[model samples]
Target chain A: MIEVKNVAKKFGRKKVLKGVSFTAEKGQITCLIGINGVGKTTLLKAIMGLTPFDSGEILINGEKIHPGTYEKITFIPDTITMLPNMKIREAFTFMADFYNSWNAERAGELLKFFRLNEDDRISDLSKGNAAKVNLILGLALDVDYVLMDEPFSGIDIFSREQIADVFTSHLIEDRGVIITTHEINDIEHLIDKAVLLDNGVILKEFDTEEIRENEGKSVIDVMREVFQA
Target chain B: MNVKFNNRDPVYVQVIQHFKEQIATGIYEPGQEIPSRRELANQLKINPNTAQRAYKEMEEQGLIFTEGNLPSRITSDEKVFQRVREELILEAVGAFVDSIRTINVPLNEVLQLVEQNYHKKGDSL
Candidate 1:
């Protein structure tokens, strides 16, 4: 389980993640939905300890995680930043060395699941395949938490479904995930909790079913109401 | 299995998840003759390529094995069944965790609830 409390961050004169706070449960897929330029990526980076937050606290498994605890959360940024010339299998080996929780079998299965070749270089892969490689690496990590940024924003439809399947299969028991994405339809069923952000603040955070049953409206409908109102 | 006219995602891959669920719940048994590609595609309103993709995925996963061009049947492989069962169990556990978390139940309470339910079910049995 992970908790972010009163988290605040700023970039130059602009403030992002303005004292935002939320709890993501273990073994649950919690999604972050926000329009462009709303600090979704910044919040994720803060959680990963890749970016410094100005104030507030982050705790994973009740242990306060600061800049020093970056290992606890594995992140796959929207951009594919891995070396362009490394082979697919070599990427796995590199990951295994860096992450204590890397699972080779799971990684291999994911490569097959995504229909990716081990001999392919990261640079030679099309945009979709590179995303697939990022996904494989993120999912195969045995970390307590994963934070993905816009994982499906660029992939084609066919690759998108396969990405969803890979995401679904990577759910480990009691681990947590916070996926930031604009493509909600592709992952609607995969997400149990939704947090909507606007202007660097959480506008709505609720269980998807609670809104559906109590208000007779789906999360997408609620988002429309919030944005429209 | 039609490929060109259908989706590049492949029909057989689609069938893999569906039949895995069916087999997990005993809706489809080993040695059972699955519906033909044409019938399945019509039922699902998908192209034959999708059906083929599903079948091929299931076959590669060892859930089903085809002998010649005859009616494809579910594999009677016990090992495959056990693997599928474990995977389904893991999935069910994940869903259960998601359900509890959505209600904002604390982690300790959830673990206690699972423990209580486990014993209750054991006693009932």
Candidate 2:
């Protein structure tokens, strides 16, 4: 399990992530939902240790993150980070060289699954294909946890659906996933838990199925009650 | 294998409901092998954990059974199969009765309309 306990951060006194706390369990897809600039990206970056936090602790399986943690967890930013001139295969080579956990066979399978060609240049690919490549980069790792940032934003509907299909495939079967999305309509049924955030604080954290079963309310319905209150 | 799930029900409950529907319609035969939980999740585009929960519930209900390492199969017990069909029928009829009662329609008239439309729809199909 990945536990974020009472984490708070500030960027030159702008105070992002105000004492946020949540737990994302393995074999479950946990969603961090908020509108734009609610510190969603900041929180994910803080967990990945990409940014410094002022207070609180983040633990993975009861240990602080270290160099070895990279082998067990991966963070995929929203945008493609490869050099624009690199071909998809070249990018795969770059990842293989950098990370010991890179799985070439799985990478090749994901390439085919996304119907992407290795020879395609990153700069020349369409927005949806680029997003697929970004996702494949993290998913092909043999890590136990994956943190994704706004994977569905700005993509076409078909591409969004194709990405949603990944959550159900063996590609993501047993790993813990933390995805941040401003919009939930596309993949409402794919998530296990939702942690609602607003203005750098957690508003509500509840199991999606529990709300539906006990309250007969959808995630959006709960969001409306919370956010619109 | 395609299920258009609603957002207001627990996904595991929805999955079991789908299985019950398939069993009632004879689309899944008695003693036939069903897809593994992972396969069902992929086919329906739902979370694998939800699929696992549904399978576990079905197993507890005796709707499907597994022996040792073999794949799970639909119940071959004739009484259980008959009960599943009757349960579906009664549920549908109960919903029909509730709606017709709300509209203040007599039971005889509702039965007559059902008899007329059921065959007409079946023939057209």
Candidate 3:
């Protein structure tokens, strides 16, 4: 399990995450959902130890995050993180060199699944295809936890469908995932837990299935009530 | 199984309903092996846990059963199959009656409309 306990962060004067705490377990998808600027991405970054937290702790499998944590936890940022000028095949080779967890077979399958050409440069592909490549890079890893930031944002319908398919496929089997997104329609039924963030504070967190059965409300329904007030 | 799901109810419930409808409509035959949990999850693009929950519910309701290590299959017992078909038909009738009752139509008029519409497009019900 990945645990974030009382994590707090700020930039100059503005606080982004205020005592945020949550746990994402293996074999479950934990969703961080809210409007823009609510620190959704900041929380994801904090978990990755990419951005320093002011005062808090992050633990994976009951151990404090250390240098080796990156091997276990892979974070896919919203924007393309690959080199802009690198060809697709070169990018794959670059990733394979850096991480021992990179799976060449999985990368090959995802490349065919996404229908991405290896010869195309990163800067030459369309917005949707670029996102697919980003997803392929993240998913091709043999990691335990995956933290995604706005993976479905600003993509076309076809691309969105393809990305959504990754959740149901064996690509994410038995791995913990933390995804932050304002758009929930694409992953409504797939989310196991939901953390609702507002103004750097967690307004509510609950097992999505419990609320659905007890109150007949979906993630979107709960969001309407929580955000409208 | 091109199961079309809406966002209104819980997905597991919708999935269970879809399976029952499939059994009632003869899409799933008795003793036929159904998709594995992972296969259903991939085919329907739902969470694997949700598919597991749906399969569990169906097993509880005797709509499907597993034999030892084999994959789950539609129930082979004729009585169970008949019960599933009857339950689905009753549920549909109840929904139709409830909706028609809200409009305050007379029972005989409702029956006449049903008879006319049922044959209008060669619908089975």
lDDT for residue A147 in candidate 2, whole number 0-100? 95
Q: lDDT of all predictions, in order shown? A: 0.75, 0.91, 0.88
Count of backbone clashes, every candidate in sequence: 14, 0, 0
Model 2 regions more than 4 Å off: none
Model 2 TM-score relative to the real fold: 0.98
Q: Scoring model 3 with DockQ, what do you get?
A: 0.68
Which candidate tops DockQ?
Answer: 2
Off by over 4 Å in 1: A66-71, B1-125
Q: Residues A123-226, candidate 2, lDDT per residue (tens digit)?
A: 99999999999989998899999999998999999998888887677455889999999989877888999999999989999999999999999999999998
Interface RMSD for each of the candidates: 13.2, 0.9, 1.3
Ordered by TM-score, highest first, the candidates read 2, 3, 1
What lDDT, from 0 to 1, does candidate 1 have? 0.75
lDDT of 1 by residue, B83-122 (tens): 8888989988999988988899999988898899999999
Per-residue CA lDDT of candidate 3, range B81-116, in tens? 898889999999999999998999999998998889
